[model samples]
Target: MKKCTIIGKTNVGKTLFLINFAGYLGLKFLDISLCDDKKILKKYKLSINQAIYELVNDQTHKTRCLQSIIVDVPMGKGKKKLQLIDTVGLIDGIHSNIEIRKAISHTLTIVRVSDIILHIVDAASAGRDELPSSMGEVDYQLAQFAQLKRGYAILANKMDLPDAKEGLDKIKSEFSGNLIIPISALHKKGFKEVRTFVAHNI
Candidate 1:
């Protein structure tokens, strides 16, 4: 299956996007597979609400491992199934925790092999200054690297925020050549465009 990985800095709504995007695709219960550093895969069945409560968090590095789910995208009369993988958040500098550093390394490795890259950036934070989720060096580097891939796109998240428009404009100016989709993962805005992009690429 095509693997589309959601990557971004910590607390940028990657987990929330993963859960809401699956819900937007008409999934009430999700079959999720979580893979640890040892490559041990564990599967779980959770409702949409349960997944949010368990996975989404405000703290940094809440997700330590790789979590994946298969979703069917509407393709012609039938459907195309692809894997949506949520990775550990990438930080700019080295993390103090050895485990977190390993998780970040794993995230980078998966990006190299994934079929599709959904690079999410916190638009609202980008609009402001000194926020943890603001656009950083890692984001710029990731954009440059991932754009070389066939199915790479930037998702300007948190568009519902007041300052998000400014942030979106900045992202557009910086990533003029690449495909950038403005989305509010919390409110599920601009999801149709994202779905279309993913479907065509996958």
Candidate 2:
């Protein structure tokens, strides 16, 4: 199956996007596969609400591993099942915590192999300075590296906030020529465009 990985700095709504995107795709229950550094996969099942409550958090690096779910994208008549993986949040400087560094390494490894890359950035934070979720050096490097892939796009998240417009404009100016989809992950806005992009690529 094709794999689509969601990556971004912490508190940028990567986890919320994962769960809500699945919910947008009509999935009532998520069958999640948590893959660690050793490549050992542990499975769990949860409803959309349950998944959000348990997994989504405001803390930095809350997601320590690869959390994956299989979702069916409608094709001509049948459907295409793709592996949508949520990754640990990445930071600019070297993370002091060893485990987080390892998780970041694992996320990078997954990025190298993924068929599609959905790079999420916080639009509201992008308008601000020095926030954890603000666009940084890592995001720039990621855009450069993922350029080799055909299915790379930037998701400007948190559009519901007042500051997001400025952030989105900044992202557009900085990341020109790249495909960008403005989305409010919390409210599920701009999901149709995202779904279309995924469908066309996958």
Against the unseen true structure, what C-alpha lDDT does each candidate score?
A: 0.91, 0.93
The candidate scoring highest on lDDT is 2
User: What are the per-residue Cα lDDT tens digits for candidate 2 across 144-192?
Assistant: 9997899999999999998899999999999999999999999999999
**Model 1 residue 51 distance off true place after TM-score fit, in angstroms:** 1.0
Q: Which stretches of candidate 1 lie above 4 Å from their native place?
A: none
Candidate 2 weakest lDDT stretch, 10 residues: 35-44
The count of backbone overlaps in candidate 2 is 0
TM-score of each: 0.96, 0.97
Tens-place lDDT digits, model 1, residues 1-202: 9989999999899999999999999899999988853474798999999999999988989999889899998987889999898999988888999998988888898899899999999999998844689989999999989999999999999999889999999989988999999999999998999998998898
* Candidate 2 C-alpha RMSD relative to the actual structure: 1.0
After TM-score superposition, what is the CA distance of residue 37 in candidate 1 from its true location, in Å? 6.8
Clashing pairs in 1: none
